[model samples]
Target: MHDVEAPPQERTRFQWWHHSHPTFAGITGFFAGMLFVTALPGAFVGVLRLLFSHDTAEQLFPFVLLALALPIFMLVKRKTRRFAQFMFVGMLVTALVVLGVTSLVLYFMVDA
Candidate 1:
């Protein structure tokens, strides 16, 4: 018996990001997008909190807007555009859900 090894295929950093088929691509992209969407902010805030006081961190929070450039770049590039679209959708949905839940909670608490 003999075993043969396959040569490694070369892929760009993001080339293998999406699954082969569209269906799985969307599903995986959605979750991956969600994770990437959350992680950036989480990391920024974590770093700010570690390095600065609350008021300073609050003041600097707006700087996080700069992070939007990454997705914008991804969207502009042809290879990453598809994945970036899914990431954009995931980010939008996450923001909406967070606001909706927060509003409902505040409404219930304040109105009661």
Candidate 2:
């Protein structure tokens, strides 16, 4: 049996997950950079607040950790051409981790 080519219409159909569009990557990278930048001041403030209250300290500590992603991304990007993709993934991971931890803490604190 010989291999058959895909139909022309099928070939032209959009494969949403098969391609990494540059514009999409750039947009994601921009937001990721923005988020990384935004978290920095928040982490700084959180650290300062930590000095005054244990509760606030626990809540804010994670943000300080979250702020670390930006520097890590920058370092990784410096050595690779796929910086945008890296930034996008890093941002998403950072956001999810930070949000998940924060939500869990709040849930426990409220329940207690």
Candidate 3:
């Protein structure tokens, strides 16, 4: 007599997404960085307003500079360096666009 029952298969392990494709990783990181650049200052200010007086919040505003260390840390690590590079480029480009638009608006408002 032969054994007819089949052995049970092993369950697959959970895998997290890392955006393995270069283009996908780059685009995801870039947009995420752009959003971070635009939203962080406002979010910080809002939180400060909620937690402290106007003068205190204004004085503490520069603390936002500390956030820069995150990307710098990401850059220092080989694992996240590629994504960080794209993120940095996105942040710079977004900042430039924001500054350019703001300056143009200020100039036109002053002229008018």
Candidate 4:
């Protein structure tokens, strides 16, 4: 057996990656909200694509409307501080839930 020097400082850094916590949370929430919003259109298109044998309005409408709605919703919400706060909190929670559900589905699908 050979003697080895233990690096306690290095081990301490490895114990917790401080940089990733807030970044991961931000990224997770960002992508989750984006995915949730994007999927609304995707679901519509998937259905229409299946039914019509051709992609048309459904392929485009939901995404287009969602894109348009963001600005409109913001503008309307701006009329009241309370409403804006409520909308923001609502969207944040929704994003977290969407991320959670997406992760669960992916976990099971991958495991299976």
Candidate 2 vs 3: which has more lDDT: 3
Q: List the residue pairs that clash in candidate 2.
A: none
| lDDT by residue for model 2 (1-112), tens | 9999899888778554343665555555657655764676676876678586867766666666765665566656644335556565667777787789999999999999
Q: What is the alpha-carbon lDDT for the whole of candidate 4?
A: 0.58
Off by over 4 Å in 1: 1-3, 6-19
lDDT of 1 by residue, 1-112 (tens): 7886554553454555656656664665577667766787889999999999999999999898897888789889987778778878888887788889999999999999
What are the per-residue Cα lDDT tens digits for candidate 3 across 26-73? Answer: 897798789779899899999999999999999999999899999899
lDDT of 4 at 102: 97
- Per residue, candidate 4 scores C-alpha lDDT tens digits across 1-112 of 9988669988787665553454444454455455545575677777667766564754555554555466346547544333334444545677678799999999999999
Cα shift from native, residue 73, model 4 (Å): 5.9
TM-score of each: 0.73, 0.34, 0.79, 0.39
Candidate 2, after superposition: displacement of residue 109 in Å? 41
Query: For model 2, what is the error of residue 1's alpha carbon versus the real structure, in angstroms, after optimal superposition?
Result: 25
lDDT of each: 0.79, 0.66, 0.87, 0.58
> Which regions of candidate 3 are displaced past 4 Å?
1-18
Residue-level lDDT for 12 in candidate 3: 27
Q: Considering only N, C-alpha and C atoms within 3 Å, which residue pairs clash in candidate 1?
A: none
For model 4, give the 10-residue run with minimal summed lDDT.
78-87
Better of 3 and 4 by TM-score: 3
